[model samples]
Structures are given as C-alpha cells and as structure tokens.
Target: MQTFACQCGATLFFGNRKCVACGCDAGWCDVCRRMTAVSSDGHCLGPGCGAAVAPCGNRLAYDVCNAFVPQSATGETIRCRSCQLTSVAPDAGDPQNVHRWRLLEAAKRRLLYDFQTVGYPDAQLTAAPPLTFRFLADTPEKHVITGHADGVITINLAEADPVHRETARQQFGEPQRTLIGHMRHETGHFIWMREIEGQREDQSASVFGDHANPAYGDAMKTYYDHGPAADWPARFISKYASSHPWEDFAESFAFYLDMRSVLDTLRCQAPQLVGAGAGDLPTMLKSFQEAGVALNEVNRSLGLTDLVPEVVPPAVVAKLQFVHDLFQRYVAAT
Candidate 1:
C-alpha cells in the first residue's frame, strides 16, 4: 500500500473515500494511479462539465477505477476498464445492491492493489482477453458460480451473505475465509494462466508435479466423494491443494504472496529487517529463513500458528529460484 494526497496537500490513506482536510472526496485516477479530489456536486467527468464537477463519475459511479473514463464514453454508457471486471452488477438503485456492491468494490480494489505491487501482467500478456468480474444475483432460473474465464471473473452476490460464506467455510473446514482470500486465490489461478504457463509451466511440473499428471475433472470428483488425503498437511499447504496440479500451483502462488506480505509486515516492527533487502537469491533466502524462525518463535509464545507454513523445501526452492531469476531478468530488461 502507498500513501496518497489530495489536491489540498492533505495526507490520505489507502482505501479512503473522502479527504478530511479539504472536505473533498478522494478518487483514484486510473490513468496515472494518482489520487484526485472530487467535488461534491453530482456531475459527470465529461468535458462539457470541465473540472466543474470535482468528484468525477469515475469516483461517483464506481468506488475507484484504474482510470477515468473520458467524457466521450458517457454518451455510449460504456464501462470503464477497471469496472469492466463485473459481467454483472446488481441494479445500483436496488437496496441490496448498495451493500453488496460496496463489499465487492472494496475486495476488488485490494486485489488490484496487490496486483500492482507485484507487477503481475494481465491476460493481455498472452494475447488473451482482459479480465473482468461481475456480481450476479441469484434467480430461480440460474445459479451463480465464482470462477475466472478468459476475460472475466464472476462472483455470485449471495457469497457476500455472511451466513452463506460461513456455511461454506465450515463445510470446507477452512480456518478462515473472506472476500479478500477468494480474490487472492482466484487471481492466483489467472496469474498462473497468463504469466506462469508454457515454459514456466514445464518448470513447475518438474518441481510440483506433471501439470497433466492428474485428471482434474475426475480428481475433483474423487476429492469431494472420498475427502482429502490423510497426509494432506505434510505435502500440501491447504486441503484444496490436494485437488490437482493446477490447484496446487494456485495454492502455492497464493501462499508465496501471503508469506511475502506477512514477512514485510513484520519487518516494520523489527528493525533487523532493514538489511534483509540488500541481497541476491541465496542471500535473500537466508534472510527470509532467519526471519521466519524468529517470527515463528514469537508466534508460539503468543500461541499462534507459524505465520508461514514451512520453509521452501529443497524441491520447491528451485522453482521459487526460477521465479526470482525471471523477475531479476525482467527488471534488468526494463
């Protein structure tokens, strides 16, 4: 997360909607990823209004978007690129839509934030379609599923219901489940498809397992029918990872990011982390391992699980090395 400011120079926080100092609304200008001040008036960001409407449609209609839709788009009623994720948004005017849409937007913004920090390319990298998401309302005629396709990720609006989500969590025997977790886990799948497949996929196969070794469709059927393997924890990060190779990759990817973020968070509290960033792959892993041990001891003192599951095993370490090499190469090229 990065700090932002309003036009008045007032400091703002991530996910803020309004500016406290100048009484202005805080909006994200997706074009530059900068924060803009929105006027309180109900006006469009169209050229006709000029800068007269301070809080532009980009902020008013959608909480925050990647970029401001230009005035020409208003006449066509086209969706903004960031908001395009939704294949379905409940009627904005509907009472239920207010609550659900806000929840969806907040979760989506967090996903975008993490994606930005990591520089993970979008589906455009594969000459594939751009991704989008939708909030689908359940009806007698159809059921909503939460999954990603070539260009869209559709989430059933009912998943926002606490009771429903809690029920699913319990049935799955997960310790924690939230909108953010779903977005993180699902985005892992998308990233695997867009950025980590092909050559990278072959490498993952050598470490994780053959990508096609498991019959996915039937593997899932067997999982639910027979339950998770008894030794799942020894080999998998979570029960879902036992489903298939693709799933194992997604779970691993999510865990990698989770571990990185949590370690970064702890570094803020412990100054020893200051020197951890200055290193190559082997050096960095040593730093991470040291930090993990110290952090795990602290967790045990407080009676919490080790924040990270385990050290990168010898087999998995090489795959993570590949990822590090890829990023370093990319950085140098850029």
Candidate 2:
C-alpha cells in the first residue's frame, strides 16, 4: 500500500488511471513496479524512467486493469503480470458480469501486490510455483465452485457481488469475508503445494495434523454432516478451519497474510507502532491485536464489521508462526 510519486510531484495510487492533483495520466509500470505518470502514447513518464509499455488488454478494452505489459512482450503477452495470471475471466457480454469482473480483477491486483511487497514471487521468478486464476459464474449445467487445484485458483464470479457474498458470510457463520480474502485463502493452497506438500511434511504435520489421514473427501463430508468441533475456537483460527488440516493451514496462511498487510500499512503510515516492520509472527500478531482493538472499535462506531477478530487462539498462532517462518526463509534467500 505504499504511495508512489508522480512526475508532477503528486502522489499516485496503485489503481489510479490519472493523478487527481496533476491531471496527468498514471499507470502501473512493469519495469519500476510502481504507479507512475505515463504519456498518451504509452511511454512511462516517471522520473528518470522511459520504458516503453503497453496497456493491458483489460485496461484498453474493459477499463479493468491499470497495469502495463512490457512493450517487448506485446507479441506474446498482452496482459500485465497480474492480469496474465488469470487464465479465465468472466464474460463481459453480461453487464453484471462486467462489474463483477472489474471488482474481481481489482482484488486480484491487490493480492498480487501484497505478494510482491511481502517478498513472494509473482512474475519475477522463473522458479516460482504455478499460480493462475479462473473467474467463472454458475450456469445451468455447471456450478462454479471456488477452490484451488494444481496451481489453478478458481474464484466464483458471484463472490464479487456484495449481496451474494454477505449472504454466504452469514450462512457460513464467518466473521468476515472478501474477494481479497478468497484470493489469499486459495493462494494459500497454491503455496502449500509448492512449499509444504512434499517439502516440509514433518513440520507441517507438527503444526497442522497429518493432511494425508482421513482422506480429504471423507473429512469434508463429515464436516458438512456434523459441523466443526465444539471447541474449535480453542485450536483453530476459524470454525471452518477445523474441517481438515489442509484447511487449517490455508486459514492460518490467509490470516498471516492479512496480518502482514495490516502491519506493513502500519509500518508505512504509523511508524511509531510498527517500529521495525513485521518481524515475526509473535511480534506481528501482538501489533495486530493492539491495532485491532482500535480498528474494531472504529468499525463498531461506524456500524461496520470489525477489522480484526477478538481472539487469536494459541494453536492457530503457532500455525501462523510456522507459515511466517516458512516465508521468511524465502525472503532471506531472495
């Protein structure tokens, strides 16, 4: 969530198509990875930067993406790195789908940016794990389910509709849910495939139970038939997390990313609170709780949902710590 400087000395934001103060056009430059002023013809006009870039097809056609594709890659790559990761996009013919797709892409952009800031590889690393997305809507013959498999993350288009999403939240008894939360949770599975599945079985089992046992399908059926354990709050981050070990990991990973986002914003905007950045899970969680109290209070005052939960169970914290350490290693190696 770091702000970028425009050539006109105005602050530019990530999704901004034009700088409000300077009236200069702004775009996300692939070279600098920042929102910077761009000329009408697609030359990056940022300070000391003149990389030739092309607007993503989604940007030029749908006004959905604000990023650019490298000019040299125009032949083979018509989309920006973030937009490129999407293998399937919602149909634009439907007016509702257009709005829903726009919101979905917006969330995906923020998710990818969070990954970039947190030191996770997106388009930068050839060795990085495969991660792609599909934004599909339910049809007469097909039910679009949201989940991840073999590096592909499928997000149901309805999630972008606030009414549909809020209904799901109440039905599932979830404290909070959003498009970005869905991205983080599903990417959690993608990361587990690359980093945890075969790489650190022992450590993962120690943190979250053996995912191999009980068979995921059987476990899922049992969970649906007979809700989560009554004492799940003691050991899991969410009731749904108690369904299976894999779910626990994803929930923990998603929450870890959420905390990281919060702490990173704090470090940037309120340096006094963050002090040394999000150091470790323990430190980060402590800072989040301290800030969450105020955040939750503010939401309460405004009659909005709480930004953070009232509790972070010790067991869930351990799982988050494991995830934190795992990614920290990647950061250090990078």
Candidate 3:
C-alpha cells in the first residue's frame, strides 16, 4: 500500500484519521479514492464527504466512528457504505460485538484498499442499501454460517477466534488462512458478478464451464456430504473450487489477488526480480516466475513451502495471459 502525505508533506498511513504534521483530520473517501481533511470543529458524514464512513450511532455513543454518511440522512441511525455490505452485524448492545466488529472492519477495509488499488474502480463501501457485516453469536441454538449474498457478507464471529480459525484451516486443508484471507475469498464472490458480464461471461463459461447447470443447493449438499472431488489439485487452485463453478471463480479470483500481492512484495523486497521493465502480463509473468523462484528458494532456506504457490501449469499460464489481454482490451475500450 502507498503512504499518503498531508498537505504539509508529512507521511501518513492511508488509514490515518489525523495528520500529525499538519494536525489535519483525514479519512478516505470511497468516491474520490483519496484522503480528505475534515474541519477541526465537526465533520459532515454527507454523501460527498471523503472521510472513511462508519455508523453514526457508534460515533454518537462511542465517539470512535470514521465513516462518512449521506448529508440527506434522516433516520434514527446511519450506516456507512462499507458497513452495508454486511448482512450480519454483531449485536451492538453486546460489548463483545465491539471487539469482533473491529476485527471484521479492519479486514474489510484492507480488502477494499486492495480492490481499489487494482483496476476495479466500481468497488466501494456504501450505506444506501448498506453493505452490512453480521458477526453471528456462537450458540448451540443457532448454526453459524458465513457467506455473502446480494451486497452482504456474513462472517461467523467464531472465525475471529484463534483456535476456531486454526481448526478451519486444518479442516479445509488450506495452506494459508486468516481473517483477511476469508474476506478476500468472499469478496471474490461479490466481484465475480461484475467480472463475468455480457458476452465475456459466455466466453468465461467456455473456459470455466457453465455455472447455471448445477442444482446449486444439491451440489453444495453433495460437497459437504462427500467432500471435494478427487484430483482437485490437478485442476483447481483449491479443493473447494471443485465443489461448484461459482466457487471456482472465487478461488481463481483469490489466486489473482495472491499473484498481485506477491508480485508487489517482490518488487519491494527484491528489485532485481522486477528488473528495469514495465511490461504486459506475459512479460510480467515471466519476470514474476523468476521472482517466484527466488522467493521459493528463500523460503526453502527458511524451511517453508513457498507461501506463493507455483501451480500455474503451461495451460494455466496461457489462461493468465488471456486474462491480461482481456484487462488491457478493457482499459482501452473504456
């Protein structure tokens, strides 16, 4: 992530609420995708305000909100745009909700930051229909489930627990798992709706296969009953992807994120890997492969399987090239 500087030229993190050098209060505007300063006395949560928006109720009582809301707000409580993506929020009345909500918020903001940094301009947190987050209480009477629907993402509050999350990682057989990973994986489902639009979706269908064919409910039932398909690793990035087409899309999206982030990290940690070139995806892919090898060697020295997997077969690499070409064409057409 890039660091932001205040008007006075003092460096600040992207999420800084106040600029220490200039003593200016700052928050991110989803619309502008930049930091905006708020007046010292009070700030507006209005539509145009660039401040990182949150729930007004949290602000009034807790005085800890950094969310921006619409100027036309006329309700008992106002929710921020990002918060609206959540369909399940922990009970505000419950004190434990505060800590759990904070954890989800941090991960969600990070996901948004990464999304915006990439080419997806339409990604934003809004309060209109509201992107809601529900942290479900873990109780025997209730079955906690986490997923996204419409604009909402539901996360089981138990996932925030170290033991619970670790257990899930083992159960799912995922090499890497974290709250951020969960958010990234789920957001993939949300963005897939945007990616597979128009005829391109049909073309994507040819590659990823038809998503509409399955009795989705039945497929999910069979998946949970019998587990992911055998030989899943040969074809899929993760076992879960073998469960359904939608899941494959999400897994592929998550791998795309992993690629971008790992590439960025290499650019910083090993400039030699990037070399002296700005190239298209094929060229970038070659450079990235070299970087990946170097990174893997380093990991091996440290006794770790490369956190960045080298699973792109020759055919998969070509598919990645196709995606890169598609992205370039998209930018040109837009």
Candidate 4:
C-alpha cells in the first residue's frame, strides 16, 4: 500500500479515521486515492470538485466504515463505493459482531485498494450480477465456510477475531492466515468467474486445467479426506490450492496480488532501492526472493520467525506469470 499524508502533514495510513497531529476527521478520497481532511461543512478538502461528502451510511449507522460518499448522491441512503458492495452484514445487535464486521470491512477495503492500484477495474456492484459480500456468523450447530458463489463472497465473521483465526491457522498448519488473505483469495474466484471464465478459457486451461471436469468435486473431496500430495510444494503455492483446478487458480491469483502489493509498497517507500523490477514477473520474483531472505534475517535478528515463510518455487512462479499476463490483458482491454 502507498503511504499517505494527512492534510496537516502528519503521516497517515489507509485505515486512519483521525489525523493525530491536526486532530481533524480524515477520510479516504476515492478520486484522489489519498487521505484528506473533511471540512466542517462536510466537503472533501482534497483535489477535484471539493464536493460536499458524507460519511458512509455504514459508518453513520454502525460506526464501522470510514469511506465517504458525495452528499448529493442519489438514493435513499448514501454508501461509499466500498460499502455498496456489501449485500448483507452480520447481526449488529451484538456488539462483538459489530466489531468483527468492522475488522472485516477494513481488510476488504485494503483488498479493494490493492486491486484498484494494480489497474483492475471495479466490477460495478450497481450493475447486474454485482459483486457483493455477506458476512455471516457461525452458529452453535454449524460452521460457516468462507467461499465465493456467483458474485457474492461470504465470510465467517469469526475470522476477524485474531484468536479464532490463529487457532484455525494452527489447526490447519498454515504458515500464514489473515482476513486480507481470505478476501484476496475469494476475489480471485469472483474475477475468474466474471472476467476470465469465458474470455481466457484456453489460456487458463493450459495452466490450471479445465474447470468443467467431472472429477472436480471428487478432487476436492479427496483433498479434504487425505490432504494434498506430499510433493504439492513442488507445484502448488499452498495445500488448499492442490484441491482443485479452480482453487489452484485462486491461490495463484491471490499470491500474485500479495506479491504485487508488497512490491509496490516497497518501491514507493524506498525508491532508491533498485533491482526489484516493478512490472516484470521474472525479475520481480528474483527481487522478491532476495528481499525475503534479507527480511527473514532481520526478523531472526529480532528473534522472530521469517516475515514471509513460503518459497515461490519455479512451477508456482510460472503460474504467477500466467496470472500477471491475464491481469495485463484485462487492464489493456479496459
């Protein structure tokens, strides 16, 4: 993510709601892609028209979202572009649920920012077959699985709780597990269905296999029953990715976004640092590996585990390249 500065000149972050130095209300400007001060009259003090804006409806109602919407926006309710994608929210009567939902929304916004920064066009949630979200709670009798269907991504609010998420991460033996990771992975599924399914069928098949295979369900069942092949690391980015062709594509896509986002942030923060090819996949991967090594060493010096534990093997690298190429095509078309 790019570093942001408040109008007061204080360093700000993407999720900041108040400027510490100036004590002014801050909101992200979708047009400028920066954090800007909100004037007393509710106008954005950033670039563009300085239009009168209102806090997201979700924020006014539940104190969750930090996005803003034009005050004159049509409709009975005003929601920021990000909140407009949420079709359903968890039970807000419970305060804990509200807090968890807020965390999920924050991560979701970051995922959206990453996509926007990388030139992915927003899938208009106002259009037919809109991209949407459903944050659900796990009941006493049943567990909620995080998955994507149609254009809706359903997230179990439990994942927003670090304790629960960490326990699951340990249970599943994953090197990393995060709410943002879940959002990125599920988004891959949505993009595949909406943008890639028919458009790049031949190219996708050559990398991830045909999604129409009759054994796809069996493949998933086998994976859950017995787990990934021992040599999965040789080809797959993660064990879950080895379950099905669709999953493989999503996993690779998620990792591609992860790498690109981190690389972009690094470049912005340390422009003097060279050799990290920002646009070329092969050179970027090489730079990533080198940076990972140095980062791991720094973590070790601080008596912590490696910052990035997964190794990007050659097979995974090739898959990542395919994803990069597909995204470039999508951007060019747009």
Candidate 5:
C-alpha cells in the first residue's frame, strides 16, 4: 500500500482512526484511496469530497469500519462503499465477535483497495448476484466453511484470530495462511464466476483445465483424502490448487494479486529500484523473486520463517500470465 499523510503532515496508515499529531479524526476516502482528516463539522478535506462526510454507519455503530460516507448519500442508513458490500456481519454484542469482525473488515478493505488499484470493476450490491460478504461464527454443532458461492463470500470469524489461523495452517500444512490470503483467494472465485466463466472458457481451459470435467467433484474429494500429487510443485502454486481445475485457477489468481501487491509496495518505497506501473509478467516475477530473497533474509535475521514460502515454477508462471491477460481485458472493456 502507498503511504498516506495526515493534513497535519504526520504519517497515517490505512487503519488509523485519528491522527496522532493533530488529534483529528481520520477516515478513508474511497475515491482518493487515502486517509484524510475529518473536519470538526464532519467534512472530509480529501480530493473527492465536495460535500460534508460522515463516518460509515458501521464505524459509528460498532467502531469496526474507518471508511467515510458522503453526507449526500441517500438511504435510511448510509454506509461506505466497502461496508455496503457486507450482507451479513457477525454479532457485535459479543466482544470477541466484534474484535474478530474488525480484523476481517480490515483485511477486506485492503483486498478491495488492491482490486481498485488493479482497475477491476466495482462490486455493487445492487447488481445481479451482487458481491457480498457473510462473516459467520462457527458453532460447535455446525462448522462454517469459508468459500464463495455465486457472488457472496463467507468467512469464518475464527480465521481472524492469529492463533486459530496459525493452528489451521499447521493442520493443513500450508506454507502461507492469513485473513488477507483467504479474502484474495475467495475473491478469485467470485471473479471467475462474474468475469471468466462463460466469456473466455477456451482461453481459461487452455491453462486451467476443463471446467466441464465430469470427475471434478471426485477429483476434489480424492485430493482431500490423499493429498496432492508428488509433482504438484512442478505445475501447481500450492497443494490445494492441485485439487481441481477451479482451485488451480483461483490459486493462480490469488498469487497474481499477491505478487502485484508486493511489487506495488516495493515501487512505492523504492521507485529508483523498481519502476512504476505493472510491467510484463516475466519482469514482475523476476523482480518478485529478487525481492523475496531479500525479504526472506531479513526475516531470517529476525528469527522468522521465509517471508514468501511458495515457489513459482514455469507452469505456474504461465497460469499467472493468463490471469494477468484476463485482468487486462476486463480493464480495457471497462
């Protein structure tokens, strides 16, 4: 993410609610994609704010969102663009649920920011099969599965807890697992349904296998029962990706986002070292490999594991290129 500065000249991060230097309230401007100071009269001084602004209803009610809504927003309850996409939120009455929900929202906002940065179509709740979220608390009797259906994505609130998520990562033997990763992966499923399913089946199948395969379900079941093939690393980005064609596509999509995000962050911090704008797939992947090496070294110095544990083989690189081509097509169409 790009660095943000408060009106007071103090550095402000994405999740900052108030400027430490000026003690002024801060809210994120979706149009500007930055955190800006909120005036005493509740007007945001950000570039896109021509009218007064108010904290999103979710922020005012539960202190869970830092996004802003223009005062001119119509409706009985005004929500920020991000919050508007949430169809179901976890219970706020429980303190633990509230905290976990906040973590989920934070990750979700970052995911949406990346989507906007990459020029994806805006997710509107009013659209047919609108993009939406359901943050559910898994009960002892019924387990909640985090996945996407139609345009709606469901996340288990337990994933928001670091310890719980770490335990799951160990259980699944995944190299990387985080709330943001989950959001990115699930959003891939949504994008496939909305953008790729019927429009470019031939092109998608060329890289990700046939979506019409009759043994798709059985393949997924067997994958879960036994595990990925020994040569999975030669083609798939992750073990889970080897489960089925759909999963391979989603995994590659998520990896594409991850690489883009890291490269963007590097460009912002060291423009001299890395050029601006998305470069070609090979160039970007090469830069990511170099950066990952440096990042892993730093992590090792700090007594931590590798910053990025996944390896990108030639086959995975081809799949990522396909994902990039699809994104470019969507951007050009829009």
Candidate 6:
C-alpha cells in the first residue's frame, strides 16, 4: 500500500488512527481516499479535501475502525462503508471479542481498499444480501461456517484467534490463512454471482467445469471422503479448490487477488521494476516470480515461512487470466 503524508510532514499509514508526528486525529477519508487528518471540530485536513467528517460508529463505540463517515447534518455518528457491511458483529461486551472485532475491521478495510483500486463494487460495501460479512462465534446449538451463501459471507469468530487459525491451517494443509484471505476468497463467490452465474455459463464452465454437475453438497461430501489428488498441483490452485468447479474458481480468484497485491507492493516499494506493459498479467507474473525467489530465500535465511509461493502452474495462470479479463470487462463496462 502507498503511504500518505500527514499535514505534519510525517508518513501516515493506511490504518493509522492518529498522526504520531503532530498528535492530530487521523482516519481514512473515503471522499479523498487518503489517510486524512481531521481537526477537533470535524473538518478534514486532507489536501483538496476539506469536507466535514466524523468517526465511524464502531470507531467511537469500540475503537475498532479507523475510518470516517461524512458528518451528518443531524450530528449523528454513522458507520463507514466497511463498517456498514458488517451485518453481524462480534459481541463487544467480551474484551477478547472486542479485540477480534478490531482485527476483523482492519482486514475488511484493506480488502475494501483493494477492491476499490481494482474496480469492484464491493469497495463501497453499498448493500446487503449480495455482499456482507456476518461474524459469529460458535454457539452450543450453532456452528458458524466460513463461506458465502446468497452473498452473505459468514465468518467463524474463531478465525480471528491466531492460535486457532494456525491450528486449522495446519490441519487443512493450507499455504496461508488469514482474515483478509477469507474476505478475498468469499468475495470470489460474489464475483461468480455477478459475472458468470447466468451470463456466461458456457464459457466459465468450459474453463472450470460445470459448477452444478454433481451438486455442491455431493462434491463437498466426496472431497472429504477422499482427499485431493496427488497431482492437484498441476490442475488446482489449492487442495480445497479441488472440491468443485466453483471452489476451483474461488481459489483461483483468491490467488489472483493475492498475486496482484504482491505485485502492487513491489511496484510501490521498488519502482525500478516498472516497464512497458508492467500492469499486464504475464509481465506482472514474470516480475513476481523473480521477486518471489529472492523473497523466499530471504525468509529462509531468517527461518521464517516462505513469503511467496515458488511457482504458478500454467493451468492456474489460465485461471488467473480469466479473472483478470473478467475484471477488465467489469471496469470497462462500468
């Protein structure tokens, strides 16, 4: 992510809640899409962005968000776009839940920022049903499954507990798992609903196979009955992606998002890599591969988990290309 400059001439980060250099209250200003400093009287101090602003309700109530909503004429505090999409928030009475809620909002804001930059509607988190997050803890009578159904992306609160998430990641043999990953993966389903479900079934099914052939429930049951094939690396982006065609698409979409994020960071932090066609898929992937090797080796030297995957299979590249093209069309049509 690109860093912003505080009015104090200090670097400001995306999620920073205050300017450390000048003790000014700070929050992300949606109008300017900048790390904004605001005066005590609610006037935004972002360059060329002097609108009135107020803290998001969650920021005021639980200190979970570092975002501002346009100040209401009635002087009522409101949720920011990201906070508004949270249909079911974690219980705030519990201290741990409050912390977990903060983590969730931070991740959500990152995902929304990426979406906006990439030309997706979720950036605004404008409505419900088609896209929303339901963060629920498991109850004695109910288990919160982390998946998308009818556009609602339900997350198990336990995923915010690093220990629990790590244990589950190891159990499933996943390459990586985090709150942001979940958001990207789940939104992949929403993308399917928007871009492919009824409009281009033949084209999508030709690439990923028919999503409804065996039925999702049947496919999921069979996947658990027998693990992924040994040759899955050649055909699928992840082991879980082998469960069904829809899953394959979601996994590939998630990978594409992840790849784009890495490439963006590289471009911002190391501008020397920018060349003609720098934003093109193949060019970006080639650059990422070269950088990934160095990044992976550096992580090894530090005895840390590899920061990037070693390779992207040709099959997965095709899937990524599909995702890229879909968004290109999405952006153009808009």
RMSD (Å) per prediction: 5.2, 2.0, 5.0, 2.2, 1.9, 1.8
Model 5: ten consecutive residues of lowest lDDT: 118-127
Those runs of model 4 whose alpha carbons end farther than 4 Å from true positions after fitting are 73-77, 123-127, 273-277, 302-305
Candidate achieving higher TM-score, 1 or 2: 2
Over 204-262, each residue of candidate 5 has an lDDT whose tens digit, in order, gives: 88898887883778888899899998999999999999988888988999988988888
Query: What TM-score fits each model?
Result: 0.75, 0.94, 0.73, 0.92, 0.94, 0.95
Candidate 6 global TM-score: 0.95
For residue 2, give model 2's deviation from the true position in Å. Answer: 2.0
Q: What would the per-residue lDDT of candidate 2 be over residues 1-334, giving only the tens digit for each residue?
A: 7778887888887779898988877878877777888877878987677888878888988888888767874354487877888889888899899889889898888887787778876433234556889999999999999999988899999999999999999999999989999998998888788888778988999889989898899999999999999999899998888999999889988888888888777787777766585576677788889888888998999999999974887877788888888778869987
Q: How many backbone clashes does candidate 5 have?
A: 0
TM-score winner between 1 and 5, please give it.
5
Q: Write the per-residue lDDT of candidate 3 for residues 1-334, one digit (tens) a residue.
A: 5555555677656556677777776655444555555555435322354343433344345433454454333445665455545565677777666667767766776666665545544423352333456668777888877887765667888777778887888887777677877787777766555455444677766666677778668778888999988877666767787787777767766766666655655565566777543367666667777787877888889997576664665545544554555445545665
Candidate 4, RMSD to the unseen true structure? 2.2
- Between the candidate structures 4 and 5, which one is better when assessed by TM-score? 5
lDDT of each: 0.62, 0.84, 0.63, 0.81, 0.84, 0.83
Clashing pairs in 6: none
Against the true structure, candidate 4 reaches a TM-score of 0.92
State in Å the error of residue 237, model 4.
1.0
Candidate 5 lDDT for residue 62: 92
lDDT tens digits, residue span 49-109, model 1: 3243223343556543323444453344444445656556777677776677778776777
Error of model 1, residue 301, in angstroms: 11
Error of 5 at 278 (Å): 1.6
Enumerate clash totals for all models, in the order shown: 11, 0, 26, 0, 0, 0
- Candidate 2, residue 37: CA error in Å? 1.8
lDDT score for residue 6 of model 6: 84
Q: Which of candidates 2 and 3 is the stronger one according to lDDT?
A: 2
